[model samples]
Target: MHNQQQRIIASAAQREAAQAARLKIRAGFDRSTAGLAAGMTQVNMISVAKDWAYDFLLYAQRNPQSCPILDVLEQQHYHSILAADADIRTDFPRYRVWQHGEMVDEITDATAIYTAHPELVTFLIGCSFSFETALQDAGIPIRHIEDQHNVPMYLSNIACRPAGRISGNMVVSMRPIAAERISEAVQITAKMPSVHGAPIHIGHPESLGITAIDRPDFGDASRIAADEIPVFWACGVTPQAAIMQSKIPFAISHAPGHMLITDIPDRAWMN
Candidate 1:
């Protein structure tokens, strides 16, 4: 039962506070801590001294989807990473530490690493949440978001390219749909490639070796009614799982569902 510790936090005020902090930073301030106390749990904490943005980029290019690099945050700089106003360490609820392809420990903060070497690079990748609105817009519903829980993600038999030291089978999140609407659902979701694109497979759980729909490799499972057929989509969790397997020398990623909120609007990906 302890495969992964799931943290429950109030995300309502969290989002509102994060948005306010972003706005204040935009208006010119030393930093924005408006959402400092935001109840975010299990955000991946990682930091390393010495310039390593190039290494992160190279790793990303090799493993694009798994590590879809959204924003990279540097110690004192803000741009491709996190904004200068934010602190990389202690932002999330928990942190998983990976060194030399091995998990050393999970902690609450990595400030000590930054204290010694402030030139570390932080990267944020695209999360499956980026496409949830689209799914809702197309008349398809999301169960986890509705339940205010982490979307159920599974590590399937599918394999991703070995980008440097990262490589593993694809991970997918499942959504239940009426058996009749499966085709329409796939067509509608396929348009958004930037956000894990579309459904990788239809209703065959065995084909993907899913085993049980209710028991997932990560996150709590959602209810699937008898009238509903389980639909699966390529999940950002795929990369995280891969990185865990690879045990990169030094790596960091968002804890599942605790994504880095970005300024990129929903419509930005429409084109």
Candidate 2:
């Protein structure tokens, strides 16, 4: 907990708002947030109209591994109770705006949309970054971060159970782990269930219907070394897939990897 607290203090002292805003502005031009804001709890954000809130929450509830709920904010609220003094709209580096299930725009802020429709309900879903710190602490390397690329994510054959109108194939993020360190990665991540928990699949992506290891469906491709096995974890991006499938009238999601760095300590999510 000491280590986690130190990270929170250090990051907060740097003014997360300025960092986030700068990152967002830069991402709008280049589009990547792979290794930013290291050590803090980064959360995936999704927002829908108040009318669809119940169904969306049920969807998250049914898919805990992919859509672990960290906080639920009602219409018109931007501050997160989970992350003290945090602004959900501007704290995130980037955002994707969807209209009728189609991606309409990618922006740095969501204030305009929220202002137009104040009844939007926002959900903060746990992100895998929380566990990545733990894995790094255990001497496990994150290849994407090493190469300064977005973490590779894939759409798997695994289908999430339908919750109302929201249902789709499970999406996963992959990290190349040395054969001998697979168990160590599992043990470290398993302790943080709120942050997507442990790896769902290790080695051989084809078993999960992923045809190419280097050609990922989302994010950047990561190299798999000869001695390394690809470890897959259910990803926060899963909801975006579900949202696309559901084709709801409107929705907002944090651009992949551009997460909300919260004030909540990483240990708070540890079970």
Candidate 3:
């Protein structure tokens, strides 16, 4: 089944209310928030030991395009100035736990883990949701949303500048845009720098070292229509790649497409 043609753009208040309600359920969902909280900022979550927080923060500073830091919550700090009274541990629908550079398990909630490891620091990174909303406003078609699939992501040949123990290849999200509107999409997304501004590469996927566009390293594969070309944007998931590559003793990150919806307005990130 196909999703509606008219994009669903909700007000900030409406999205926040709905997110809060969804999070209140005792059992968490395994759903993607790709088009949810339409006009609000959706940030990615990362938690590392207090000892490793400095390295991760430095890594984000080194790779702003892929790891834009929105808010840094100190040890056991749950409340965010960017998000009003939102619980980091339970807000996101899903979480990935990593130990020794390996994904140990996927869990619905990390509150218990956080309670146990009081020294873990949380970092909320910027996401592409804001730029995505802008593209929809400009009359560009988002194929993944129409087909109800998570945005396609892949690890690229490009390597991020290493910061201490954190370093890895950059990851990107792909969206198929009509060849004619490719430039228009670039201009629209460029306005939101904090949310991965503009396309890093357009057209051939092999140039970015992607062997098969149909087989993505993360998220669902998207169909590239005959008239459309794939547009790649640096993804927030790059940090997860970094975590896995660096093999941090322990770390936590939001599952791809399941972001932490913040109270900040989408417009706040406009360049």
Candidate 4:
């Protein structure tokens, strides 16, 4: 009974935090969602035309580690089942609008694009942030959250399996885990397969074709402590990388580190 009450309280708190964060975002507070809405699930979003939706879906299936899809909103739908009454077009802190694989604009609100292209299909992919609270609860430190910076992400030479017209390399987010706690960190995240589970690589960045540890292709670089080793996880940004490399005629995605804060409790995704 005691544990049940605790869960009820945590669920309510997660809902409150998720709603508040969305409200702030809708009001034009543009920033990374890292460490925001603690204990709630967060997701990355990508919207492509209806005709291109199946290809993207196949790509996600072929690359589950990098693209664990949670919810998909069909053409003309801007609402997601994961978050009640949330507007996908404006809830994310920032969005990248793409044209022929080129990023044309970065905006706080994506309503204009959705309004203009109502036929677009939106996919909500799982984010690593959803499993962060678990790591924190396990007494593991998250360097980017502690430093109040966006998590560093890199484009790797590791190629993703091709699906239809969609094909590109994988993108990965890095976290510096203490050498002693690396096992614990991996175990904590491995249970949440829906949220890019487990470290895809650890220690050597070069193995993944990352040339620099301090400079990243996306988000902010984080400091690696003397006792820590860089741990890499498959990143949802992989789809955006595909959009760029595949030269998708049109697409939109949440900016790296800028994710959709959903009402779902983080515990819901835990194994």
Candidate RMSDs in Å, in order, are: 9.1, 3.4, 5.7, 3.4
Whole-model Cα lDDT of every candidate shown, in order:
0.57, 0.82, 0.85, 0.91
Q: Write the per-residue lDDT of candidate 3 for residues 194-261, one digit (tens) a residue.
A: 88888899998899999999999999999989999999999999999999899999999999988777
Better of 1 and 4 by TM-score: 4
Q: Which stretches of candidate 2 lie over 4 Å from their true place?
A: 1-31
Cα lDDT over the full model 3: 0.85
Residue lDDT tens for model 2, 1-271: 3123433343455457535644554445345655565666678999999999999899888989999988889889888865666677766767899987899998887778789888799999988878877788888899988988889999999999888878898999999999999998998888888899999998878899999888998889988899998899999999899888889889999888877766665656666
TM-score, candidate 2, is 0.89
> For model 1, how does the per-residue alpha-carbon lDDT over 165-249 read when each residue is reduced to its tens digit?
4467888888888787777777766665555556778788889989988898877798887888888887766656665676555
Q: How accurate is candidate 2 locally (lDDT)?
A: 0.82
Candidate 3 structure, TM-score to reference = 0.92
- The deviation in Å at residue 121 for candidate 2 is 0.1
lDDT of 2 at 72: 89
Candidate 1 wrong stretches, greater than 4 Å: 1-17, 20-59, 73-85, 116-120
